[model samples]
Target: MDALLFMIFAAIAVICGINLVVQTHPISSALSLVGVMGALAALYLLLGGEFIAAAQLVVYAGAIMVLFVFVIMLLNAGTEKKLAIRPWGKYLGAPLLLLFFGMMAYVVQRILPESSPVVFGAFQGGTAAEIGRSLFTVYLLPFEVTSVLILIAILGAIVLARKEVD
Candidate 1:
């Protein structure tokens, strides 16, 4: 059951990732990215990384994607121009991509063939309390640095907007 669920979500993620790359319009690519993030969140849930899964949904899929869509809208981004592809590229690109994917799969299978299957209750320590404790304790410096980086980004955006107005 767990393997089946993992496979389903993994497939969804892969398809969405491809769609994100292949879509011509920015909005379509953004939507595809959201689908990929959501599928990844489900896969994280299957792996029992509950906190990480929730963060992925809330931060990446929700807030980040909303911000992306807002920027795309504000910038009035249009669909990408279609470029003429070489006949050789049209024939070879997909086959090369598939070959690369197959090689990666084979490498992963060889490396982790005996790995244990993920079960929901098999792992623990993903609770909010534990995560908070770890974040404040072991990961405090990195957390603080990230907060500062975000603050700087916000300030930079404000400055840029002000300059545009002036």
Candidate 2:
């Protein structure tokens, strides 16, 4: 079951990643990004990281995607086809991509821990009590900061969507 879920998410991640690179349409690219985020959330769920999975869904798929959609709508981004990359840009692109890959590889190698400790506990109830206890006990500062950041984001989005005063 785990293997199957892993394969499913792996495939989705790869496809969405490729779409992210190759799709020319901005809205389509954003949609593909949502797919990638959703697949990652599913992988988190399979790994027993339920809170992380929910956060991924709520933060990435819910708020971020809606923000992207709103921006696209506000800008009318998909109304016209974007111009193709120029030949000179294409000439410099391949090596840039290779350099980016190399840099990411180096960073991952440098940052990844040799061994990750396994966390054992159940905290999946969607009520305030379960979440509040976990947040206060384990992830107090980050949880509070994340809540504040989300509140700020909501305010910002509302401000952006408001009618302009003449």
Candidate 3:
């Protein structure tokens, strides 16, 4: 089951990455990126990281993707031939893509250190109660600060979309 889930996530990640390169439309690329993020969240859930999964979904898929789509729509970009790449872009694109993949492989190989997973006994209740308690108690200040930052981001988005008054 874990292997199947991992395979599915790997496939989605590849598709999202290819779309990032080949999709000329900004909105489509943004949506594809969100798909990648959602796949990552699912993977986190499969690894018993429910809190991280929920955070990924809420912060990336819900809030960030909505902001991206909103900005794309606001720009009123069209899918015209003008969106096509220049002649030189075609000549340089394949090599650039190859270089990017090679660099990514090198970075992954170099930076990812091996670590054994820690096994622990199951709790009496579950993670939700523990996470909630910590969020309101030990991590209360940082959590409240994050909420404030999110609020500011929401207000900034609204102001950016509004028409300016003389």
Candidate 4:
């Protein structure tokens, strides 16, 4: 049952990701992204990451997607215009991507031959409190740096939006 559920959600995530890339309209792309996020949340649940799953659903699928849709609508984004592809991209893209994937697969297989199967309860992504503890303790510097970067970005936006006096 767990394997079946994993397969289902994994397929859903892959399909939604393809849909997201293929959709031409901004709204349609955003909806496809939401579907992808939902599938990822289900995958996290299957991996026994209840907190991460809930966070994925609430923070990504709910809040971020809502913000994306709102911005798209406010901007009245239209269907994406077809762009001309570079010559090399058109001719060599598929073969290069395939080669990269094959190389990565070979390297990973060589490095982790004894990797175990992902079974439920095999790994816990920790509870909210434990995550919070690590976020503030072990990862404090990176967290503070990210907050400062966000503050700088906000300040930059405010400065850019200010009107100049005549």
Question: Going through the candidates in order, what is the number of backbone clashes in each?
Answer: 0, 0, 0, 0
- Estimate TM-scores for all models: 0.83, 0.65, 0.65, 0.84
Residues 1-166, model 4: lDDT tens digits: 8889889989998998988888889898899999999999988877778789999999999998998999899999999899898999999998999999899999999999997777877777566877888899999999999999989998987887696746
Model 4 segments more than 4 A misplaced: 161-166
lDDT of 3: 0.80
Candidate models: Cα lDDT each = 0.92, 0.82, 0.80, 0.89
Per-residue lDDT over 1-166 for candidate 1, one digit per residue giving the tens place of the 0 to 100 score = 8888888989999999989989999999999999999999988887678999999999999999999999999999998899999999999999999999999999999999898777876777886788999999999999999999999999998998778563
Candidate 1 segments exceeding 4 Å error: 85-107
Candidate 1 residue-pair clash tally:
0
Error of 3 at 152 (Å): 3.0
Report model 3's TM-score to 2 decimal places: 0.65
Residue-wise lDDT of candidate 3 within 1-166, one digit each (tens)? 5677788998998899789767878888888998899899887776667777888999989988898898789988756365676888999988998999899999987887675532222223335777889889999999999999989998997887696857
Clashes of 3: 0
- State which candidate, 1 or 4, has the greater lDDT: 1
Model 3 poorest 10 in a row by lDDT: 117-126
Global local distance difference test of model 1: 0.92
Better of 1 and 2 by lDDT: 1
Better of 2 and 4 by TM-score: 4
